[model samples]
Target: MLEDLKARNPHIAIYPVSDARFSKYGKVLDGFDFNQCLDIMQTRPIPEEGNCYVASDAELMGTDVAGELSRRFYAGMPVQIGYCNGNSSKLNALEYHKGSEVDVAVTDLVLLLSDIRNISHNELSSESVEAFFLPANTACELYATTLHFAPCKTSSDGYKSIIVLPAGTNAGLDSIPAPKCEEDYLLWMQNKWLIAHAESIPASKGAFVGITGDNIEINY
Candidate 1:
């Protein structure tokens, strides 16, 4: 599958999530059992088109590993459990939170990632992006500095991934505040800062247009 992905997307680098190249962005998580969580995720519905993200879900949080995740992975910090299920295949946008995000892939999927450090004057080039493949049932953590968005599908059946984050990370803000710095303009939701491609849906919704170059689409 990885070789097929590489052959089809020859213009960019693609690696398995276990590769050393993934270390800079985040680490492959271990110790916690994600079976129960994966089971719950299997029941979540994928949208007929595009993607659907739930910031938090009670059932997902009720899993036994949720407490272990909070106590161990998050160091006692309050966290939310949710899922992103979709058929998306484009690099529509990139977003980062102030804390690490844990993802447990319920199915095989591809993630388009970049480094926040590469941003200059609030803009990032699509050329800086790299792709990583996450196989079914694998879990990994994306650091606060890792720029990411919805997972791209690796097959026509679409994809499902369990998302863990500090509570309220992607919830809508009650009020928009005035920008205090250039980065503030990229704030799209509570604790979520984003840079959208000019052609993305987020761009049309007024997200800061900061991605420069082609809005990359993965050919399945």
Candidate 2:
């Protein structure tokens, strides 16, 4: 199965988190008890298709892990703790925040990423994205410049990941601000600027669909 996934997506290179190439953008977080956050995921059910992502749920926000994330990553700025879980096979879209985001893999998963610079004219070319494999119980800080979204499962079972970010990230906006420029159209959620492939659910819901090319999906 793993061999088939690689054969199907020859363009995507999957690297381990320890690879120096990965360190160019983010580092593995150390000294944190990731299980406390992983345990929170078990309290709820994961969606069977695609992913279930909550930006800032109260239960996740209340954990000691949340406080540590805020103190260590945000310089004491309030942070929100959420999770994205379930079976995802596609890189349907990419969204980024003004602040760094920390993702702890409760189960082994795959992350699809693209450099922020590749986003141009409000569009992100699908050709530029890369895939990275994250092992369970490991954590990493994705810089503000990294473009990402939900995790893709590594196997048939699905995945669980704890997402931590600046408070209010991915929250719904009270009202849509009229776009002053091309960039403004990407602001689909509070603190979230997105670019979605035409086939993604976000695009179907009328998010400023700005991606071009195939909505890359992993075979496994």
Candidate 3:
């Protein structure tokens, strides 16, 4: 059942989730016309986790031909296809401070060399993996496990550095010093509930590049 989630490589194109109905800060527009834009891919969490820790300098995960990572215990890391395309909008600027106490992150882009060590996760084993987002060419990071806002669109060439946090049981993050969302963040918060799920498919069809092994070297 898990293996069926993947599609052929050629058909895969990471699409920008332009949710016109939902608010950018992840609030449901009551009585607004809402239709989940299908035909892209359905982001399913292979070894999905709602709440988990994010170690500093984490990279978005990918897969090998043998398909072992997604099939094994290491498959549930972030997926880095490329950088976030069309890179500039107020919403595009998901800021990251040096050190913060939080959990959960979803990446808009892969982390570059610099911000890699500057960031960190709670390292929660069997805990709610945080979701996060890091931006390209910028020197910042979102608070780990802090639900600032997300669904950042990746560029055709992919982004250089971006980071998110593991999911946690914090309700809406009003207490913590949450990261600041760009002015119009509510627009992209189309599928907040769905985004929290570990094993959601990307909407349409594409290659499922999941983690393969412990070695982070791209043999491809």
Candidate 4:
């Protein structure tokens, strides 16, 4: 895929995260210290305005979505036993840890709702940018401190990842309120809080600091 990206000259990385193994407790093998980011699939509607934005800071931008490939294709899940992929709809949303920048990804299904359309990718040879349409139920982990885009999730069951980045790291901006013309279009927020720099990672000054079962102040 990397070669394909290079041949296509998109100047992007399409690394499919090889399953690094899940922990005994079943959490996906956690390692990167990059800032975490995620959002819950909006399950309910705004009680105040039936069609308008609610004032609550927590009003979500999501809906019921799940893997559409489960019925027909080999929606692989490396972490599971029987199938390559699990009930991805049951997978958790995007997440980032403290001290890391959040990486957002997105896709468009409303564009494919009719099943007769094709996603448009504007490819180039220079270091420009491109968008993605993560087939529903697909989740990816960006390498530590890697620059990526606001992810596009079309699963009605919702899709996301919680990120954990270096302390004091600058993360990309919230993707909910992208510019009017940019809405519904997957974009790599180049200047937001989600993007991070080497200086922002945990100071490799003394020892390593990691999260424990309960507390966070402990240092290793």
C-alpha-based local distance difference test score of model 2: 0.84
- Number of colliding residue pairs in model 2: 0
- What lDDT score goes with residue 179 in model 4? 36
The reply for model 1, stretches above 4 Å from the true place, is: none
Among these predictions, the greatest lDDT belongs to: 1
Candidate 3 per-residue lDDT over residues 122-152, each given as its tens digit: 1111112222233222223223223332232
- TM-score rank, highest first? 1, 2, 4, 3
Candidate 2 on 3-91: residue-level lDDT in tens?
45566667687777788878756779996776767777888677777678887878888778778877877889998888888898899
In model 3, the runs with Cα more than 4 Å from the true position are 1-135, 148-151, 162-220
Alpha-carbon deviation at 121 in model 3, angstroms: 25
Residue 108 of model 4, lDDT score: 21
Off by over 4 Å in 4: 1-13, 19-144, 152-220
Candidate 4, lDDT over the whole model? 0.23
Per-residue lDDT of model 4, residues 149-204, tens digit only: 22323333333333222322332435435435521222223222221112222213
TM-score of each: 0.98, 0.92, 0.19, 0.24
Clashes of 4: 63
Give candidate 1's TM-score.
0.98
- Compare candidates 1 and 2 on lDDT and give the better one: 1
